[model samples]
Target: MSEAVLPMSATPVATSRAPTDWNGEAMRRRIALRYAAERRFRLLGLCAVLISAGFLAFLLISMGANGARGFMSTQIKLPVDFPRSPIMIDPAMLSTNPDQVLANANLPQVIESSAQAAFGKDGDDYISSGAVAALRKAIIADPGILTRKVTITVPASAGIDLAAKSDGSEADEAAVVKLEQARALSTGFNGGFLTSSDGTDPTVVGIWGALKGSLLTMAITLALSFPIGVFAALYLEEYAPRNRWTDIIEVSINNLAAVPSIIFGLLGLAIFLNMMHLPRSAPLVGGMTLALMTMPVIVIAGRNAIKAVPPSIRDAALGIGASPIQVVFHHVLPLALPGILTGTIIGMARALGETAPLLMIGMRAFVASPPGGITDPATVLPVQIFLWSDEVGKGFIEKTSAAIIVLLIFLLTMNSIAIYLRNKFEKKW
Candidate 1:
């Protein structure tokens, strides 16, 4: 009991430490540094987006500027006294075969005479060669014009057209000024650009032929590729046994997707052209070639889309006594359709813009008319643009830009339709 007398002096105590200052300079600096890093990252990302947008804007603006002129054409008005002119044609013949009758009517001579009477002897030089066709169309539309004096407006020559629209040589500028002073020269929408077909004259060339060819080619490509690609994907993903052969096929497909597009062109040339004896420069051949190139892409996309369908869905279907085929076709396929369509859009878009494959198959030929069928000789928009771009004429520059604009519109329209279909089929699990 006496030992407890020294215990109070020997007692140990716990120490108290100061709390961390979250708002202090060091701590605040660290938080600020993290926020600053995030802000820098965001700024860099925004800058990248802006730069990309700027480049796109520049391209679009430049194209629009150059292409807008292509949609317009310059015209010169001339008064023709057809009754007094030495034009030989029976107006009655127009109702049966107007083009032939007009062709034989020596309308070019009448136009030359009218131009000389209206402006000068050199006035014929300012008129486009397309004027004869224009006059023929007008005469056929109004046979009464042949019996009376009337003024007819016709497209000007390429040089005169350039002067009226943008820049030109001194002689062309002078011609333009003279025509303007007479109130004879004017600019109007180029209706021919949409209605006519390719020709030696740029003013008369139209995109309809190439556009139709592209449509036909793409139709064939889609018809051949989509079903086959989907089936291949379904077999590989759902039915194929896990073996070396399947693995080799999968690897081959992946490699094919990465192969150069020109290689596909060569393959098409060798097989479709040399072996199959398919029509050269036909949409059918072009489409078949593009289909070969596009199938692997569709298959890869389809397999991934099918794989993303949950295993539980399959389990549930099986639990309900649903057959394997029924479960895949009714449930899995519907669920995977949106993603598959997305892949189709990508593949089709690539095919639409491709030239080498079609070119190799001889679709680079100068198609004068729209294809009546897939087997008809034709050229797609890309090949047409390529051909136009290679021309030495200044008029083709505008035509090339215009064709590009048309191609872009076509691509956008096609993608929009595909996206719409995808969204329509999209379902949440």
Candidate 2:
């Protein structure tokens, strides 16, 4: 009875509402704000990319402008009356024992005399110190040339080279002018920069030795780190039980990845050089040292890649009578390979550019010749660049920049190869 007597204000009432106004001012404002935020974010990203690109362009342009000359040689042609010159070597001796013949012939004196005869008393000063070696090489190449009058084109001295390319001292400028007037001074591609090895004279110094050493060292590093890192990742992710020991190992690996690169250098120095007695500046030791530093990064990347593989994939493989090992190797590994290669590229690139670790391991030595093998004394490109940058000679400055260009090219080549491999292995499913 009391419920029936309830007032209208006390009674429950049903209400109806209009459809949502998607085009309403509030909704439009919210949508506009989102679009504006997205636009702002895109603008920020574009600006970031442009700034990075600008820096990279500046680096390339500056290096090219400075180091282009490094890849060029200034040559001065000089007439040598070999028959009248004081070269005492028998033409026959050049073929049988050229080194001995050239050494005994006193090529420096021969070159100096030839230069002075062609130009004047200061002609010798305009010739590169490397002229002796150049002349010796020419003699060995053609023993008959030793018996006749010939014009030899040899590299100009460093000062004259600078004067021809950019700037030089007053004497060098005068020499350049005179040589130019004689049509003896000409700038040409420096094939020797790629073919020869390190030396005191910048005209003859080359990057081949350091480049070869870097390749050999990287070979060792890739050989050691890739397989080891992959297997380690597999074990840690798939097989290792959840235990205190596994946790500790996981933490240690993470920490190792963050350790200062110099720490790895010290470790290599102590173990490879002091205790194990490996060759101090050998690519073998350097490669092994770099392997230690690169492995952790590879392992971390590999683990994440492996973990990303769908569990259903493993279950399906197991359901089809595939063993666990087969599932991991045949299926999981293939799926993870692309990611693994990405990590490998990053690791290798970092190793390639590293100087502190190599320096600690004695790779800073002045390697005058390319190493015959990994165990032989060698220096990597970064160490070579570091050494060249420290030189007082103006020629070495361009050389340093040239070395940097080479290093960048090498890195790009390596990364390109790795990326190609990764793309080849990547799967859609």
Candidate 3:
């Protein structure tokens, strides 16, 4: 029986020989493969970034090239006998009844007469159709100018403007050359494009009216949405019970964020316009509708930002006998402010660019004057661009591009401000 254990000795035991050969070559091969894959991934990421950047650069360059021409206009100097012009009224009448004088003064015929006397028949066509209105505006701005003989530089026709800028056909070029040789044609910066309002005449149109409306609309939107959104987020994150109703509300808010903007337009149409009887095309209505559209986005963003705060801070504040409200207001809110502002800025930018909802509420109308209050009829920059882009006139093309440039600049400014704020107060725990 003792001899049965002797069979185990026949099986030789094997131990490590140089620690299993270290497997260095296999490990090196695996490491090399991993590094190669990583390099390929990195290159792909760089290529994607470069492609996107290139597209953005192209868009900006195209806008600048086309829109730059809109900032300039062609002008021609004209010597006019103010008292002798057909549009001239008695100086006494101008002081006593300015509106009546302006209404009776046929400025178009007057400009036509001046052009004919200066350059002959059909020469008036080379002057902008808006020259009459321009002259009228000048006279209104300074009534005393009508008492003396004056030489005024007035806007040239759209055709001549194109020709002067070297963008027209050969026939147009010949006309421009003739005007230039006569010393009547000149080019100058278009100051009116920045200071005036929307008009059918492209040479006289400007974005100021739209810009002011945008400012007012955004003001209303911000005033309503910021506080509502922040508090709604606070309650949902800090105080709301985790119940079925809360869960439904949370889901509904998230879904609202993803809803198409046009749906909100319809809702606004039904509620704000059709039922509530708010003024159509007013900044008040537009802003309220946009506030509805934007509020959900802010609530979602704010909740996420609030959730990102570490629990330790809330606990620490509570341990010091701080009220729940006090903790939220003093400690948590300050820390979360940068993120909150980031969301708010993004929402405001979206509101600034929105057109569909505003259109539904009647902001698509041609608002020639800037709004004096939120309740006044108005059109925003985006709606203005939309209208201009659809015009049949060739002059409005450059104008549309210019409006787009303005909108882009505004968006850039907002995003820059957001970036500055985020970097200024961003915190880490």
Candidate 4:
């Protein structure tokens, strides 16, 4: 149909709308936003790390500052007459009636006399009462110590010690200065704090008892926790079937790791104390309770470490005619040891610092003597720190800080050992 054909050039139909041009500005804006978001996230992470580090440093510094005073003791030099008639006796008499002679000996009078000669009016308040007891014990141990004209350095009272260290009140400052002018007051490293047992006197109180308890408790805890946890992990990871029960157990273990430590303490109270009738305030009970608390962490860590082992190791061992147990034990376990030990170290360190559980078991009791065995009554370092912190005396303030420092040192040592072991055992492959 020869209808009026429009000229091809004249019939200009609207072309399809042009595809949208790349919005360079929008692209730039989106990229810049992404980079900004990344930067903000990084800054937040760094700030968090820095804040944590700052708090830790502050805590350590504070503890160290106060603890330094505890390391030194104020002493007063006294010239004393050790009367040989009462104090210096035959060695045979010591073997036969030592207690009687010590009971009858006038050690207190000697100390009091010497102190009076030195401080004049304030003699009783100037020297530690515990120093008299210490002197009595020494003389009892060797009566010959009384034969000579003894010029001994005796521990000054806590107030005097504090004044000498510049932490005492204004009145104490005068006493300290007077003693200094008379050349009777001096500061020396306190060897007794490392050697002596816990005492009523802050000047004589030492962490040795608590340190021993911690060592014994950790030994028991490690003995119980490590093998049981490793075996449980081994079964769950290498042999246990994937099923509902296993899943429940896995979930329970993970949840247990997050449970409050005090709850475990209560559980220990119920089971170890109420049900079993075990001895209270013994390292045995403390260690058992801590083992319960630490096992979940070990299990979780162990499973993770075992899973990290290559499946090829298992397959290759099996292909070589090795049994499943042999494959896991020979090939997988050795590779996982480093991680397992790291987890163990972390658990032990946590156990060492735990006060609530130990307190629940009566470990907060005043243990005057170091524990000789796991079954003996004991108090750990954390408990000692807690007890000291609750004390009202100014002397205990420094003592509490000193105990905290000791705890930190032990923790650092444990972590260092963990690092060393991890590096020693870790394989490149």
Cα-based TM-score, every candidate: 0.92, 0.92, 0.90, 0.89
Q: Which runs in model 2 stand beyond 4 Å of their true positions?
A: 1-35, 427-429
Each model's Cα RMSD: 6.0, 4.0, 4.8, 6.1
Model 3 off-target regions past 4 Å?
A: 1-28, 96-100, 137-149, 169-171, 420-429
- The residue-by-residue lDDT of candidate 4 on 1-429, one tens digit each, is 343575664666568987655777877888899999999999999999999999999998888999988888899876676753234345566768877766666667778877776678777687886676667666666666676767667888999999888778877788888888989888889887877668888998999999989988988898999998999999999999999999999999999989988889999999999999999999999999999999998999999999989999899999989998899888898888888998898898899999998888899999898998989999999999999999998898998888888898888887898888788777543
Error of 4 at 355 (Å): 1.2
> In model 3, how large is the Cα lDDT of residue 95?
75
Which ten contiguous residues of candidate 2 have the minimum total lDDT?
Answer: 8-17
Taking the tens digit of each residue's C-alpha lDDT, what string does model 1 give over 345-428? Answer: 999999999998888889988888888998999999999999999998788899989999999999999999999888877734
* Model 2 global lDDT (CA atoms, 0 to 1): 0.91
* True lDDT of residue 351, candidate 1: 93
Q: By descending lDDT, how would the candidates be arranged?
A: 2, 1, 3, 4
* Residue ranges of candidate 1 with Cα displaced over 4 Å: 1-28, 427-429
Model 2 TM-score is: 0.92
